[model samples]
Target chain A: MAGVDMDMQILIVDDYKTMLRIIRNLLKQLGFNNVDEATDGAQALQKLRDKPYQLVISDWNMEPMSGLQLLKEVRTDTKLKDLPFVMITAESKSENVVAAKQAGVTNYIVKPFNAATLKNKLQAVLGAF
Target chain B: MTDQAETNGHEQRLEALVSRYKDIDPDDLVNIVEGIINTAQGDLSSVNLKVYGEIEALSRYIHSARQEIASLRPDEITDEHIPAAGEELEAIVGATEQATNSIMESVEAIEKEAETLPPEVAQRLTDSVTQVYEACGFQDITGQRITKVIHCLTHIEEKVNALLETFGEPGERSARERKANETSGAADAELMNGPQSSEDAISQDDIDALLASFD
Candidate 1:
């Protein structure tokens, strides 16, 4: 965790306000303070287009567009491509995971996950962050 | 008289006797007819001919509804219960979400102040706060489950209403029920539905394995 920028701008997206708050709080606990929020995939997509974020953490079951769709969009966009994208959702189905992986996800965390799991996942994805 | 003339006269008198009871012994004839109707049709004599069509319609409606809801017990499950159940589940989601927000706010405050604490104490506080974060996830899971229930209740209400429409004069839905149907969002994508409880559903570990190849 030593050399990880604590001020790295992270975007957390979910339709559920409680979840967005929970994930943002956990990220804050991990020492990442510059976090932004979007309630759904469409808004998250618009935000990504407008800003430069180091990472995007999104939920999978949002309306109009899902996290997988956002991941695909990010991968396809020349500017947003190569960004570290993690999916945190209650959609723990295997097919959902496979779809996310195929669409190019940096990491996928299931719901009801603790801070330790989140930390390890983030560390693995962001290289010890 | 001719044989044909005699036959015609007999037919005319018989028709008069059948069609016009008012002409001969009106009270006596009424009593006889009422007795016959009671024995054969169970009080049909009291029913006005003008409303016979409405009575027949009602009878048909009851017949169809009975077939549709043979097990339906109106006394046990009144018309209001299904919608009420859906509303209650929605309220549960709202309450849990409010509670979670309050908890998260407190945790955030604690986390901020933990920065100044000594490493050992701050580490313990962080651990406790981490547990709280994980516990708060209960709201998300339970919210999904409750949403599914509300969908089911909405479905049952629709079906029951469809049947009940048969028992009464059909009319356009009231504004409140119309608003409810339009707002339910029942047509959303079902493949990425809320957490599944069926045997066919996969688990977190299975999801992890699917993503393991990426690592």
Candidate 2:
């Protein structure tokens, strides 16, 4: 079943427009053609309701709905619960990590991360095909 | 395709580094890249959380209002209720706008900082930062290269704040506010494309080589 699954559909949510474009392009570069974006958690939720996304790559902090809140929302909703969520942030503090884990973040990546690191984390969370 | 081209380009850059700094350790370059990336990512995360908090507050308010609205009986539908609902919706939207602005501000700060780093490093950092930002949902930063600039500003803010503290900074509070204001305008613009693309995700071999050469 996993083998038959095509490129993963990823939802990249951030409040910055440039960041969204960068993620979309990055995913495309990675051979993942199915990518969508939401500027914040609310919009991201709307998109999630509108479609099926295999993975959600989100920023930890945002307006109206932070990544943690979104993660919690996704987890609490029966339909969206258990969705794979990777929280990307700039904070590397242990507390932040613990908080995210507690909130059910599948993985966390600190900002300014290189492509290599991002790929490794993704592999860890999404698993290698 | 674009990411592929970007990766190749990055490879060429790594090769250039190997040839250009024979006396330097490749790891040094890698370290530098890592430092920049880590710091930038940290800044991005803070921005995300700050905006997220604001949104959550607003969302909660909306939820409360929604509950109240639901509790009202059919006969309770009054002209007064209509205005209140509109006001609540306006507040929610306002909160969203505020959160968006905060995120944008952080992006701008990151971009500004990216501009200060070494060219290749700056570009890579810029790309990665932007990619994360966009994957999160911003539509405006699509083709922009402002992540570097924003990162640069954050660095400046840190330096400035540190310096002030070292000298027993008196205007510490205002200094932070001033720094925040400095990047507000940068956030006003829309986004550009994510980093060069997944095709650009550097391979371990290439990364090792670059690090080795830089070491």
Candidate 1, pairs of clashing residues: none
| Ten contiguous residues with the weakest lDDT in model 1 chain B | B174-183
Model 1, runs deviating above 4 Å? A2-4, B1-79, B164-171, B174-188, B198-201
By lDDT, who's the top model here? Answer: 1
Q: How good is the docking of model 1, by CAPRI class?
A: acceptable
Chain A: TM-score in each model: 0.96, 0.91
- Displacement of residue B201 (Cα, Å) in model 1 is 4.7
- iRMS values for every prediction: 3.6, 12.0
Q: Model 2 Cα displacement at B152 (Å)?
A: 17
- Model 2, A99: alpha-carbon shift in Å? 0.7
iRMS for model 2? 12.0
**lDDT tens digits, residues A39-96, model 1?**
8788999999998899899987775677777888999999999999998887766767
lDDT string for model 1 (B1-215, tens) is: 67789879966875688577656665566588668777764344334644676888988987876765655653233347776777789899999999998998898789778889999999999889888988998998899888777767666666655555655533243212433234233432544667766575676667767788777
